[model samples]
Target: MQANQSRKTGVLLVNLGTPDSPEVPDVRKYLREFLMDERVIDIPFPNRWALVNLIIAPFRAPKSAKVYKELWEERGSPLKFYGEDIEKMLQAHLGDRYFVKLAMRYQNPGIPEGLAAFQKAGLSKIVVVPFFPQYASATTGSVYQKVMDVVSGWQTIPEITFTNTFFDHPKFVEHFATAARKYIAERPYDYFLFSYHGVPERQIRKGDVSGHTCQFGACCETLRADNRLCYRAQCFETTRLLARELGLKEGTYSTAFQSRLGKDPWIQPYTEDMVKKLAAEGKKNVLAFSPAFVADCLETTIEVGEEYKEVFEANGGSHWQLVESLNNSPLYVELLADLIHQRES
Candidate 1:
């Protein structure tokens, strides 16, 4: 049945979640849920369970907890804080015509609660936007599946539209470019590094509908129908757009992937490796960008901003700058609003 005309449309913004607290238990819980997802681990159930429970969770949680503590803010997680801010800003921009809700794919302010709010409001249509800019099975795919799983339990579900990815969206690119310009205007940099969160090479291969489509190398250098849904390709496309916007010259900018886990080969060159290479090459003044994340979190704030910065400095680099993310920026809000409007129209 169609929704009642009197009810407003609903907008749900979903992001990769964070632990409820920086404590060990909370971090463990979050990691268990996040790593256990089939889309994420991409292994058979028996193997995946053993890997997450018997190995990764037990060993990784405590160390991860420490990192979370380091990344935690006075207001709690910067990721969750930005999600809330974006929700509020989008709601204000959209006014009362729509019900805007934010949810984390894994933790508190979850999909169920967000969906329930829309259900309570008797929304006509629901637009679910995964905060991932690129379509990766581990991120956007998992979010979509979780959203569907939640809605499946409801007796009545609204017409739901999912925005899979917006990697090349002009406004989305503009938001990052604007943020980058603010940094560039303040200082000069010898090189720009676009570092995206890495996924397994197998994951990239899995995304290819045609088996032979993803061969790495020049395969991901350009975006085409064959590799449109390929996360690595989309990431490169994002870097290209931002480079164009910033007027970065050839060889001045490079792309690398970060936050690789376990021993399996993930997309490369790894961000850490890139940092050392830049340092050795005498690219002392470096500007780094993590466009994989729209909001600053442990990965962006600690890993890239702090960890990678240390790596650069230790390897003979004098200056290492991380361009801040588009957290609750007006341009970012506008981009979200525009996405919602486009879906509604």
Candidate 2:
């Protein structure tokens, strides 16, 4: 009884890391670490190594740095700061029985550092919550594997749990819907766009252990037992939940994938193409939602909010509004607490 009462749980919240600074060198370093991951590029090690080092990192880093500079805020990258803010907030909300820590999977205050803190605190259990709403090999899966690799060396391993995916969580859906409601109330939007970070088509096929692979069609319309871990399916399910909450009609809303890299075929229709399609269809006012990310990182603030806006406007769309993410909303904190409590049971 005393042992149970004395045990303290540790919560480690992880987000995809950002460059320490939005400089060429820093961005290059960040990209090297990120793209080199097997789960991310998912190619032969020798090929992945050569591609990221020789071509992509050397050339793409400078361009990426410029964009990161645009996305940078006074305090620093919003992704990093928001994770910091949420760490303190969740710690306060959980009180003395739990210790909350923040980690970036690829950079400073990394997974190793977070786990070391839990080790020093002598925590009896650890719960990992990756910030990605939808499960993807490059994001959530990478974080899970990283945590395991680090913990495997520890002489004394504690109980560890992961909140793999929460795309269907009631609060998760409500948070996005509530954010969009504020925008909808402002004016009429001709269409609603739900954009998610794109993953390779091959990766989607790799996850289909059930043998019925992704055909990249209406198969993603609903979640099922076979495509349960499918990133595209989870993304579509997220769109459905948010649309239901906002009372958006069928024709008025659609889902697309964004941030695709390389020439390889990724899940479609691409967000950029979708924007062009909307403009061609005479949809002047569009409301875009990025539910794949829970925080307003580069993907949301810069890409979807800024870059996509450029695409829409250039293609003849008049008004484009981006529904911001649930950065530090009280409701989001509650959702995290709920996940932690669910594991505690």
Candidate 3:
């Protein structure tokens, strides 16, 4: 007990989240919580509420539940299960110096519970690692906001720190590059597509500290200080680093955004469109990467792996492969440890 007491730091690993079950009701509840967040929808409450509750969730939940059912395994959602597994694995790796807990920004094992656990442990400081490689207002930003909201009510708030973005971190880049290398060696992929989760163009602009710089074409090609926080820029930069590591030649690989929601325009070069474009150009074999998520969530496992594959094949492409996520990998655990140590220093 005394030895455990010596650990003054707590680690909270957070992911986007999943429904408690594949049932429609559970999925509906999950969607409600997720879409209702102002950071997510970024609209007036009444409008957002009506859109989510009345139109979107009501109609979309059933379809989403079907997908969740397909995604479910004997152990249930891979996203949640991996979170549980990584929590234990990371704790072991960190040893007695830290306590690690996993939380979802929405749905089961919520952020509040994770923060409460750290508070109960009486840890002097808490380090939050939002399991997103890039800095996005809807993702990492939301996690930060949720953490602050929960901890604000605590009588004695600990010295809490949050990791911003590690898009091009050596360990992170190496992990994805190594994963892609395995696929690359298996066959000759004609083109490489790095498909990151899409956020609205407005969200990117809102996140831009410099007013007019996030124009989305040439602006995103180079990662500068002004655009460092921009999601589109980071995605491009991440691709550049991964491509560099894998020695992928220019024009052979491209970056696109996937899983866009609503009517609003998302970051350009939609993955589906790119898949079609590649197929139209007679590029039969393609290897795709989703580096936005650290875990094998629905986005990675189903959307990119399955849906996009279908799109590619339908457009005359023969091979579509998704390089798996960094779920509970030793290297990823090491990366998390590095983040914690960096925050500590």
TM-scores of the models, in the given order?
0.96, 0.97, 0.98
Poorest lDDT segment (10 consecutive residues) of candidate 2:
1-10
Q: How should the candidates be ordered by TM-score, best one leading?
A: 3, 2, 1
Residue pairs with colliding backbones in model 2 are none
| CA deviation > 4 Å runs, candidate 1 | 1-7
lDDT accuracy of residue 128 in candidate 1: 93
> What TM-score does structure 3 among the candidates reach?
0.98
Which residue pairs in model 3 clash with each other? Answer: none
Per-residue lDDT value at 91 in model 3: 86
Candidate number with greatest lDDT: 2
Off by over 4 Å in 3: 1-3
lDDT of 2 by residue, 51-95 (tens): 999999999999999999999999999888888889889988988
- Model 1, position 101, has a per-residue lDDT of 84
The digit string of per-residue lDDT tens for model 1 on 53-82 reads 999999999999999999888999999999
